[model samples]
Target: MAFLELNDIHKSYFLGKEEFPVLNGIDLQLDRGEFVSILGESGGGKSTLMNIIGGLDRKFTGQVKVDGRQLDHTKEKQLDNYRRGTIGYIYQSYNLISHLNIVENVLVSLDMTTLKGSQRKERAIALLKKVGLGDHLKKRPSQLSGGQKQRVAIARALASDPEIIIADEPTGALDSRNTAEVLKLLDQIAAEGKLVITVTHSQEVANYGTRIVHLTDGQIDGDTRLKPAYPVPQEDQSEFRARPLSAGASYKNAFKHLTFTFWRNSLIMLGTAIGLFAVLLFSGLGNGVNAFIENQINSMVNPNSVTVFKNPTGKKMSSTELQQSMQQFANDPSKLLLTDDQIDHLRDLKHVNKVEPGYQLSTYTVSYNKKNSSGSGIQTWTKAFSDNTIKTGHKPGDNEIVINKNQAIALTSAKNYKKLQGKTVQLTMQWINKKNQPIQITGKLKVVGFSDNAQALAAATNYHTMRQLIEKKNGVTKANYVSVNVTNSIYVKQVAKKIQNLKDNNKYTYGAITVGDILDTINQYVQIAAIVLSAIAGISLVVSALMIIVTMYMSVAERTKEIGILRALGERKKDIRRLFTAESILIGLFSAALALLLAYGFSSLLNHILYKIVKFNIVQISAANIISTVIIALVISFIAALLPARRASRLNPIDALSAD
Candidate 1:
């Protein structure tokens, strides 16, 4: 069998919905180590034949057999491998990656083979030297001459050591002297038991080939052999030479270059980082503030606390009527509130604990002599309540008064103030007379145990219970209801149902809700904040993605020559696509890592300050938030790079090289 075979290959295209044939009935074959040159006029489909042979375009009908493998019927995955391992291609324009050094550019094509680090590096360097680029291994393509760049392109093609080296006008860009040099190099490679095929218009370059074929209108018109051909290798010769690296190595190479490339563009990195920072910071801060509010509300009252108030009576009570109510208050404080009879009935139900009747006294300021401060709240005397203290006085007796710890502290701190431990101080009360005058009292009282009831006061309320105080001063009142604290918060619903089942009239009603409900009601504003912050964060992420698109598109434009170079040097279309995608994924991962670090740093600093003031570490971030941010970054990066990658992969080698 011939080393390579193409039988009646036909390729066509559709322009404006009309069929246009590019190649028709091309029959060609060559044994191994035969140097064959194909000469054709411009647009005569010589390059198209080369493209088909290189496996760059598969839309054709023909039988192409290379070493007994059917090239035309090959699967997509196998074709990728064939391009990576079985063929080496060189183009007329010196296709070299501008961002890569001479050696790195050559090694890029070898990434798909099985070569390891040192070996791969070595093979790439040897090929560079063979192509006369030994001293320019560290130089980028732009730093090299046109002849030197084409030689580097040839070296890159040879890195995989394929059975055939397909060159399309390899010396087209060179001067007479450099053209002779490139032709001699092709002769040498062909002499080394490798099939060298060149398509060119130069007769000088074709004369060095052992055979010459002429193509006219996509058909081979002449074939002449002048030397004995070498035998085609039966074994997989790709493995004997340096193979491309593994998939893992490809990722590593992509990451390494990506790092260098981004760092080289410092301003872009900074912009991306700033955008990511905004997204991270706002989300963290919003979640933190919401959590703090929830903690505060949860601490002050049960998340499940429910207050019941009686529907108001329209007519106002006369002073006489209000006083007569004091006569009935002597029996029990509960009667002034829920009435003792109602309390007795409520307490008999399951899940019902003691029902405490309470009333609030209006806020006030306390003063001794020349010392006054406001913001004092009071609650009705409940036996179970434990949130306040009277520093130097007992509970308010019928004829005396008790002051809060803060008010007592301020009183004694004044200049010329006496140690009023037992000294009589005037308690100026409000609304005492018919004209709402303040009552000055000199009731003497001893300082007893301090009541720890001050903290329970939200702002301040004078919550005095008994009816006698209201009757004497005209400021207090009998409460209309009692708060029944259930024994078990979880069973509050059961207790409410039991109360509902009581035979009381419709005039009596009760309700209970979970602590969760109260928190939801109080923190309803948090939802708005979360949305606002998330949107702000989301905008930044979108900006980051747009930035990525701009950057990658610029990269594709800047590296058009490089993409063409890779395509000509055995890189499949998918491989070119994957390289760009890999670069983008790396960018996203980097930004996400940065966002996480910044979020953690800010969260820690803010949490410390808040904990000192509020006595709670409420600003907590969950794992879901972190995961969500990282996933978002990755998706954005992948999406942003897609268009650029596809554009790069679809670039025609001829057009890409022709671009400035």
Candidate 2:
């Protein structure tokens, strides 16, 4: 049986209900070891017949049989397998991918083969050398002459070792010498026991083959024999076999194209990078701001200290809920006053060293010599106040108080501020009793020193001294809060959790607040502001995504022919789709890398400027932030390429291969 046979093939084109027949009832029988030229004049359907035989035009009514087995051309997968495994196509226009070098262009075919990476390159180089273009392996088609480009195309066609070779107008644009060289190569290919078919209008090219089949207006009018077919030779059965392109190869191709157009893509990367940079920068700023605030507060407060309060809700609350309850408790201090049992429970905590019951006045005032220094915050001294907070003198003892440094300086002259220590001052505040009756409390206290910090800007005294002054008056008083000192800082949270979980009458009796908790509350607001800014900056990513979409669509349009070439070379639709997506993802990754650089650069400069004033680093990028930026960039780029890649993948190979 003939190695390849076409039976009763008919194909037509339709334009608005008008039928134009291109091929009519074509019947042919050809075997390996023969160079068959389909000879015809213009519009003789020579190329059309070649397309059908090559499995590139499967829309026609055709029963194609190979090696005594009929091919199911109606099935796309079958046709793809036929093209990739059995057919090798050499085009007149030398359809070499513009972005790929000569050797890389050949690998486009070899990548479909089940060959090792090294073997694919080695075979590609061998094929290029066989075609006498070994010296031009690194050169692009643009750098090669017409003949050299065609040689590269020939090398690419033979790379995967297909059974049949189809050359369409192979020497239409070449000189006589180059045309003769190409014809001789076809003869050599046939001599290797491969079926070679060439379609041409020239009789000189026709006679160069072993058999000449004369075609007239889509019909074979005559079959002429120029010479006998070459003798069949033993072939290597273990050579690389053609298969579907793998995902890795698709990505490799995409990367090659990406680097080939890096300059144009760099602009797109820069635009996308700017958006990622903004988000990362703001996130880092939030991180730095939180760190700085926590550091300052931590430095001025003892971590081992947790302030215990009477539970207003009698239930655990998240940090956000606890903040809302602060004002409610402050306005009604009578409700927040802790009983003796609650104070004892805090002292009973396993890790607790001591518990000091205290009162935090929402409003208080100090007057010395008819001059007043008023404050909205006044808390009795506890271990929560670090020794570093006191700028001068020692902690206030007995009936002595330490006020805000700025307020102390305001009431007394700055130079004599230290002299105010040991001077008697009148402290007064309004408080609510157990019966909710408001009463005025006053005390004559001596100033011991001043406390200075962002958080500690208030008047304070020993808890017992404040309790004594309030009790000495005709008003009833209670401990509004208790400061629990833990044996170690590491156990602060564990001990605090225990205190907060303590219950009375099966209801939560107390809540714990620590310096870290307060800092966390402040950081929450900072985080929100950062997120809002990042979200605003995220708008630019949308624009960048649109840019990517536009660029990908433009890429599909530009690489239309390359897509056709790949499809003709047996690439699956999925491979084509992934090819473009891989390129977009590369764009995204490169953008992320660029964004990381930009974010770090800007953060360093901003922190440098900020540290001089605040004495703290105010912009810190974290690992999580960097990772999020990369994932976001990839997702955006992937989503942006979907439609364009789909469009590219669904294009008709016949139409795409014919594109200008």
Candidate 3:
């Protein structure tokens, strides 16, 4: 048995129904240390035979035995291992990756070996030095001369230390002097006890080898021995060996390619960033608007209180229907009033700190020194009113009342509106008793405070003071509404739900409303607007995804030849896929970072401008939004790369190496 054997190999190409044979019934036997030259004409199957031996052309019907172990050509994984471990190819074209420098080009082959970090670099440097190109480690392929390029190719081929080196016209593109130097290098490679097989058409090239096999029309016409084979050396016992390419190597290569054309990729990144920025900006705006609205409402009313009213219909009502029900109070106020039993029940509820029975008249009037101002939303003061509501003075006490800026300026001027404070005014209100009869309640009160808050727009007097005035006017003091104060703000919602769920004979007895509920209704609209804006941003994101897809597809087309080289160097399908996918992911990450910067920068400026007018920051970007942006970017990139990367990985090495 020989070290390497080809047994009755046959390969053919079909053009429709016509079969064109390239190699027919070929049988050869050879051993290591023999530099064998298969000399033939251009179309006489010399290169095809080399491809069969190198494991790059596996579709042929043949049994390639190395050291008596036959290679199963049909198994792609097996062929990949055979090429990765035993075969090294030196192409005539010097097919070096354009983006990689000299040392890096050699390291591309060494990356599949088990050599660790610095060990691989050290070996690649040593190989480049051995080829007499030690000072040109950083130079790219285009910067090197023809002879230097061929030397780089030789270094890369020998990087993995394979058993057999296949040179297909290694000196074909070189002058006589450079050709002599390259042949001397090949002779040195054979002298090192490894099998060297060169495919050539030159008779002088064949004579330099140990044996010359003259191939004519895919058949051996002559076999001549010029010199004996070199002695086989002792097997290397080192643990170093070839393995599959790791994901980290794939990512590193991807990044190298990305930076090689950074300017072109930057456009894709900017477009994606703009789309992401829209999402982030709108999300922040929603947050800011929600906070501002809550702040405005909280400044006028207490958060730890809920209003309890008689549920005359004894059913849950939407906010719209509830507002309509309040309008019904003008015709019959008694029907909207809470009975004494309801007030006591509210006071006894859990988490209830205090319960105040209040009166709300639909309309009221205040006359001071013959100047009158009519108002609505007239309600007695309760715990529901925040202390901050009165910007000028204290809350109404005893015979005192608080008036808003509208009425104060109506009675007095805006500048002298403060003068209305501490001035006596005649307050008159309309209401109804339990008998369903209308009545008039009038009292002479002194204004103590003035405000511009929404809740204090209409004048408010203390509950006890209003009750006294109503009694004095021969009117029944009905409790139209009850303000229930919770022990803590957190308990407001829980207690309110209990009140709204309260039943008397299977019918709800009370309706509860809180500041949080009102804000929640308002926040829904805010969220809808944010979603609409985000949805529009999502349209741009779709376009971004398409952009990414087109970019990856273009990359696959541009790097098709490189893809072929990598596959010939033993890269797996998944590694090729990961290469492209990793680059796209980098694009996504950079875009996300850019979007975050844009969002924060614009938000800062917008908030600064709006804060002076509204007295609040209106754009608040949260940590959650940042994380969501990153996740969206990654998912989009991964999904976008799937098709292009798959197509790139599936390309045929023979055809790919031939691609322009």
Candidate 4:
């Protein structure tokens, strides 16, 4: 059997439902260490024949054997191995990676091989030296002359030291001088005892080969052999020669290609960064909002306190009626409304603090120096809900009453005089008695302190005790609101439970809630807002991911020839896919990191702006944002790169090499 043999090779194509034959039962044979050339017209199957021999184009029928190994209809893995270990392919386009140095370009061929990095580098340098490219090792393809690039390509083809070197129009893009130099190198390669087969349209190229074959419309038209007048002696083969598994070669090729094009992948990373930034921005903002709400609620609440009140009522009664009813019910002897007995019982619970009783009264109209105003009309009335334990106000005296800032403001800014601090104010205490009489008492009370925030009164209902007011307003004894506080915040619920147990059969009934419940409610609302913001960021991320996919696909189209050259030079299909995929993954990881940093910066900027308005310290970042952003970026990148990587790996070497 010949070293490389083709027996009746046949290939066909389809064009609009018509069968077009490219190769018509062509047969050829090549011996080890022979220079053979196939010359043909542009449309002829010379390059196609070379592709079949190179293990790049599989859609053909023929008995193609390399060193007695069958090639036609071979398994994909076997074909891949053959390409990696036995054949070296060079193309007319040079196919030098624009971003890689000549030596690195050559090293790419050993990616899947068992050779380590140093070994690969050594081998690459040796091949470059052999191809007269030793000085140009660090030069990119664009930096080198046409002839120099072709030499680098030839060196890359020799990286794995394959048994056969298949050249498809290797000198097509070169000038006469470069063509002559490349042809001379081919002769030297064959003289080194490797089989050199070339497809070309130049007569001079054909003349350099020991055997010349002509193809017309895919069929062999002329076959001639030239006898050498003087044959040269064979060179010694005691140098580097070994074969590793194809899997190793695939990995090596992927690494080599990725290293060469790493810088170009930054653009994809930028896209990923944009997505990550948006996502982290919203997530961080959400966390900030939640924290702020919690702080606000906690500061206003006594951590160990529980307040008892009616579950929200649906009545829209006037403020006068509400205040009167609350005061009347709380002070009523007939209705037990959280009596002193119930307060003492709740004091026995673990971690019980004070368990102070409290009440609220609204719409108590006051007149100071002819100025008249109602208590319910005050905005800060809620601050007065706290008991005297958290405040310094004295209990209501006979013919005198005390009120919060809301009430003080009402009395101060009534119709007449503005100053009512020490002035006597006429306070009208209205009540509905057992007889349902609209009884009103006019009392003279001194103006006291002003109400601040809700946090000033943690126990509730202590602005001025209603006991004196109830006594003054005869025939009305009742109350509406009540509050309780514990010794320890951790045991606030224990005290609240004791308060609830005081219910059941008691006339004094109420609902109960701890500080934790109030803060929890605020936090829940903040969390919901965060989720909404994060979702908005996610939408932008999705768009960025799609953009990456589209960009990568365009990259694949641009680098089709590069992929073909790599495959012909012994890179596996998996390696091609990995090169593209790695490009995308690197981009994503870079973007994720960048996005996190940007988010941090953006949050600081946003917080500064908010501080000017709200006067509060706000934005904060966490490790969770980093982890989540990275994971999301990786997933988006992998998903986006899937199609482009596959398409790049599946390209037909013959067609790719032939494309302009």
lDDT for each candidate structure: 0.66, 0.89, 0.89, 0.68
Q: Which portions of model 1 show Cα errors greater than 4 Å?
A: 10-24, 59-61, 73-78, 116-119, 129-136, 145-148, 175-185, 231-257, 263-265, 290-377, 381-520, 567-577, 593-626, 646-660
Better of 1 and 2 by TM-score: 2
lDDT of 1 by residue, 150-184 (tens): 89878877878777898989988889888888888
Per-residue lDDT of model 3, residues 475-589, tens digit only: 7776888999999998988998888888989988887889998899999999999999999998888999999999999999999989988888888888899999999999999
Candidate 4 lDDT tens digits, 280-317:
87777767776776665555445656765542222332
Task: For model 2, name the residue pairs that clash.
Answer: none
lDDT of 2 by residue, 264-380 (tens): 999999999999999999999999999988887777788889988778888886545655786777767777878787787666679888888888888888898889877888888
Look at candidate 1 and tell me the lDDT of residue 353.
Answer: 59
- Worst-scoring 10-residue span by lDDT in model 2: 317-326
Instruction: Extract clashing residue pairs from model 3.
Output: none
Worst ten in a row by lDDT for model 4: 377-386
From the highest TM-score down, the ranking of the candidates is 2, 3, 4, 1
What lDDT is reached at residue 281 by model 4?
78
- Model 1 TM-score relative to the real fold: 0.72
Per-residue lDDT of 82 in model 3: 85
Residue-level lDDT for 230 in candidate 3: 88
Candidate 1 vs candidate 4: the TM-score winner is 4
- My TM-score estimates for the predictions, one after another, are 0.72, 0.95, 0.94, 0.74
Runs of candidate 4 with Cα error greater than 4 angstroms are 26-31, 39-44, 72-74, 175-177, 191-193, 201-204, 207-279, 309-354, 361-451, 454-464, 467-511, 527-546, 569-598, 609-613, 626-650
